[model samples]
Target: MIQELNDEQLERYGRHILLDEIGYEGQLLLAQKRVAIIGLGGLGSPVALYLASAGIGQLTLIDFDQVDLSNLQRQLIHNQQRVGQNKAISAQQSVELLNKNVKTETITTKLTDDELLKITKQHDLVLDCSDNFETRYQLNRICHKCQIPLVSGAAIRWEGQVTTYDFRKNKQPCYQCLFPLKSNQGSIQESCSQNGVIAPLLGIIGSIQALEAIKCLLELPTLAGKLTIIDGLTMELRQFNITQDLSCPVCS
Candidate 1:
């Protein structure tokens, strides 16, 4: 039998249950779902917080780095006091504080190819909040192999982008398609380190990533196979239709 929530959860999630789309059934589904976020930096911060606040039953956060003063600008979940603490632990603490009912698992080790498969096997969805291309590529491959859905987001300078690749969904492009093998060899690949990002820019992108993950978990309208790009400077937003590539090595 499916476990029913107690009075506290019912009341706490009353607003969500009130939605016709996310009525009692949807809220219950969310409560039973598990999600994993691979990075605990700027984007992962908001993703974990919002999901926990929304009463996601289980969240696994992975990050090898510790908190630093430089991260406070956009990594909203961690504070000055948390400096020197593992980011995964800090994010888990933040989530627990927001909602004690939510369960958090913190992995303070860098994710390797083997570890990725082992850990992600049990998750319902994976959120790629890592800033590096190598980690992103690894996540895409593993998730594709395991047939898990992935929601990825990136922010640098004034630009932010969010996309969901549901490999289970027929003909959906994986992250590798958008970023082909040829681009990986490029020299001008911009990153947060090279081109500084606006502080709130991370928040904007991270929040959207969380939203997308939530929707994906609840099996609602998601950004799967679509890219939503936002320009923080001008506050302009645009969505592009994306299709799966037949020759794409990752998912094809």
Candidate 2:
């Protein structure tokens, strides 16, 4: 049951409501949507903040890691005082501080396949901000089964990428379709901790992830079936078309 915007909400989101693309009705729609963000690190930080601030009714944050002093470089949702706190809880506190009206749920442990499927079924959308390919593959499978839209983002070194998988649409590719599991098997995965990413690089990619999530919720144009890549070194942006693999094990 979506509620009408109160006077306070109207004032709080006046700029969004004023936009022709997202008017009063759109604001109300945003206020009624539920989102689940997996991983509370660099990418999840801005995605959570922007979504909560944009008036998302509920957000479920999932992460198993604790904040470290070293995370402050890119994880903006946590502070010095919160070092050692669970990342999900830290992000929850930050979201509440930004917007008390938005409800937040925290899952501080790794979720099994069944657990992930059950939780994702209850949300309007899912954001795959997890760092590892295993988690990303699991999320892609669950979201495809549940037919939920997924906004995926990744950043390493000076390169970043973002894409959306609208499972509601037929013939659209899932994440696995783009990068097959066999090809990724036994591959060396690089981490920001090892390779080092520019602080603002994650900011740029994560912010765009938030924007894509908003557009998906608002039924605006999104990067569905398209991949957007960013080269922070030369500031070059490029887009590539992604097609569904007819033999995709997950989505076929």
Best by lDDT: 2
- Per-model TM-score, in order, reads 0.96, 0.98
CA RMSD of each candidate after superposition? 1.4, 0.9
lDDT of 2 at 76: 99
101-166 in candidate 1: lDDT tens per residue? 888898998767998899989999999999888888899999999989999999998999999988
Cα displacement (angstroms), candidate 1, residue 50, comes to 0.4
TM-score, cand. 2 vs. native: 0.98
Error of 1 at 139 (Å): 0.6
Candidate 2 — worst ten consecutive residues by lDDT sum?
A: 185-194
Worst 10 residues of 1 by lDDT: 181-190
TM-score of 1: 0.96
